[model samples]
Target: MPEDNHSTVTEFILTGFPGLHPEYQGLVSAVLFLVYVLTLTGNVTIVFLFATNRSLHKPMYYIILNLSICDILFSTTTLPKIISKYWFQSETISFTACFVQMYFVHYLGTVNSFILLLMAFDRYVAICHPLRYPIVLKKSTIQILSITAWVIAKTGPLMLVIRAYPLPYCASNIINHCYCDHIGITVLACTDRAPYGFPALVLAMFILLGSLAFIMFSYCSIIIAVLKIANVQGRIKTLSTCSTQLIIISLYYLPRCFVYLASNVGITFSPDLRIVIIMLYSLFPPMINPIIYCLRAKDMRESLWKQFNRRIFTQKAQVPSVSN
Candidate 1:
């Protein structure tokens, strides 16, 4: 297992859901396909709505626009290939594409994590300091925060790739998960792996725990501010608005914290179960995000409905009546 042996592995076979029954593969593939379509269409609609509607344009929404884009790109990176793996039995991904997917998977994930934190910050400002919120989170300020998040999120994944890309992969070429990620790819390397894996674990913890702490602080401040509102109805209104983001934040962070803890720490679990959880957290948020927005954000839903009606009416008008 010399370091020079990395060249021997040109592609990796993805062994998706290793414990799934053979008879259930089709069912699983069909279900994943439906999820993939729904995730793509829903996120795409959100991004389009943000782009087209001036009413939807604002700092909070600009943050949401980033989240929507991340959801779409992240799902695109993962689902189609995984669906094809189960459907067509196509599991081989070229070496370059594998790393490319790995890069985006982590990169977009980091971006989404920060976007959620930004949204939390936005809500905190708007709720706890409504008077100064506009002054503090002006368009210029929001632009800088968005750009900073993107730039910061980019670095960790590049560090991972730089450390992992050089490792010799003489050990194995089969990934026991649905997607390429730091652990999945680096575990294939023949080296001691601690040098790669440990740093990644630290980075993952830093991202998840750090963001969670900030979000909690923001929410705590928001809570205190909400309690100070003289009108009970106003307090309830404010809390209700945060319901969607709260649920989404839970989905995004909770599973990840468990996965990292169980995997990196001393917890023992079956390999298949671990992989399933990994895929679950990664896939669940993006799939549910659009639904959360539509259910929680009335303005986005109304704008989308208007757009949908316009398209339908225009289509009906364009259609020629049957002469038969």
Candidate 2:
């Protein structure tokens, strides 16, 4: 491909979910608005509880706080514009803005993946090596791990964004999905970007699959440890604690793997269904994460219940005791 001076495409028109009927766009947008609000409310409530409740300042809560933060950022990065696209019929996004959205979408996603890995590691240490968990995951150590996840996640998307930043887009300006993504945008580049994309894709897969593999290994060890318990009740209790994390891991990772495999394996699925699956994993996990990972914790539920009652009783009493 060659650079052309008079490229006509200066923006992209995102045809969100090609099969979504025109008449139902208003309903869809309304549902998305509710989903976005719920996602924010759930994740923010977790963050608030973690910050305010002294009892939650443990290794598990620390890692979970990062997950909540990542979920909020991920929802904010992707949802607003998609909502607007449907609600206001504003389907066109400028070229620069599209790539900007793409960058954050991938960046936050990568960060969340790492955070999940950290959670798995925390659970492993807690269950498999209970005695050393406290010493192994001190406050400073957890902080380091959280900061590393945020920092290291930027490498791949940064490289891809920088290389594609200057690429000429003359092929087409229509993004056939809900939002801009590296694959969708780069495919529009006039010149061959395989040289750049291959490496970036490799790095992304390394981060994704490597974290996934480690999490799986950690859980395997956790399973073995739980199994070694001779008492039936103890084994049941141990497995119950892990059940929530396993569900969240499956929610976050399985759909992603399916979407990736489908795209790469020449699966004969319909385009509409393919896009729907991608949208589901991308948006669904953040909305449900707080419910599954944070609220599912017994301590978290008790704290939330207490806080709710406290607010209700305080409001009923009409007391304004301000002490921030």
Candidate 3:
């Protein structure tokens, strides 16, 4: 296509699960709506609990708070539009809007990886050098690190937008994925896509593998430290503290690595199956993170219990005495 032909495309249609049978759209939409609701409620409740409770105002909980906020923002960014796509057949997104969504989808994803890295570092310090943990991860230090992660996450996505956004889009505007992302958007550029696609791939790998490498190392160190503890009960207690984070990290990193790596290799997936895999890694973690915290983190568990008990007591107190 000629350079002059590039600016003709102004909007994109998102085809959510392109291979889905027409009859299944209603079911898929319902399920996605339910997931969206749960994701918001769970993550929002975490934020509310953290804000209202003084006991959770600590370094670990502070990291969790950032993760919760990212999850809420992430789900909000990607979910509603897809739900609308499935329900109302409202698939058209303006050119500017698609890029904006693309920015946030990748930006928040990068932020999440960084947050998990922070979490792994937190556990590593707490376990590997228990004596220095408090001094090392003071409130001010944690706050600074979290802010840095948020700031740093902006680079890759901004570069993506800068590189890919202005490319001539004389090709089709129908995005095959559920939400706008770097690959989904750049593939539609009318020019040779390799120059654009390769850099984005490198950036994606840098974020995923860089964070995963550090996280793996941190957990390994934690494991070594736990093994050095002679007391069986002590080892178990220390390991329990990190169990939730381990699960969250796995949920976030494993399938993502698989998908990204698989794509680069010769492996191929049907468009619908690929999107399904993407959604599994993307949506499942945010919905499940709060549940993991409530079940695994002692402080969060205690706080939830206290709240539950207080609510019960208030209800009981409100009941009228019936005996004569």
lDDT of each: 0.87, 0.85, 0.92
lDDT of 3 by residue, 159-243 (tens): 9998788889976998998899988888888888888898888898899999999999999999999999999999999899999
The candidate that achieves the highest lDDT relative to the unseen native structure: 3
Model 1 residue 304 CA deviation in Å: 1.9
Candidate 3: list runs displaced more than 4 Å: 1-6, 320-324
Task: Give the top-scoring candidate (TM-score).
Answer: 3
Candidate 2 at 266: error in angstroms?
3.1
Estimated TM-score for each candidate: 0.92, 0.93, 0.96
lDDT of 1 by residue, 1-324 (tens): 556534678999998888899999999999889888888888888888998999988787788888888888888999999899988999999988999999999999899889999989988888888899889999789889999999999999998988788788875899988988888998888778887788898897798788999999999998998899899999999998787788989999888778667766789778788877877888888888888888788888899899999999999999999996
Model 1 residue 280 CA deviation (Å) reads 1.9
lDDT head-to-head 1 vs 3, winner: 3
RMSD of 2: 3.6
**Candidate 2, after superposition: displacement of residue 96 in Å?**
1.4
What TM-score does model 2 achieve against the real structure? 0.93
Deviating ranges (above 4 Å) for candidate 2? 3-8, 319-324
Q: Candidate 3: deviation at residue 36, Å? A: 0.6
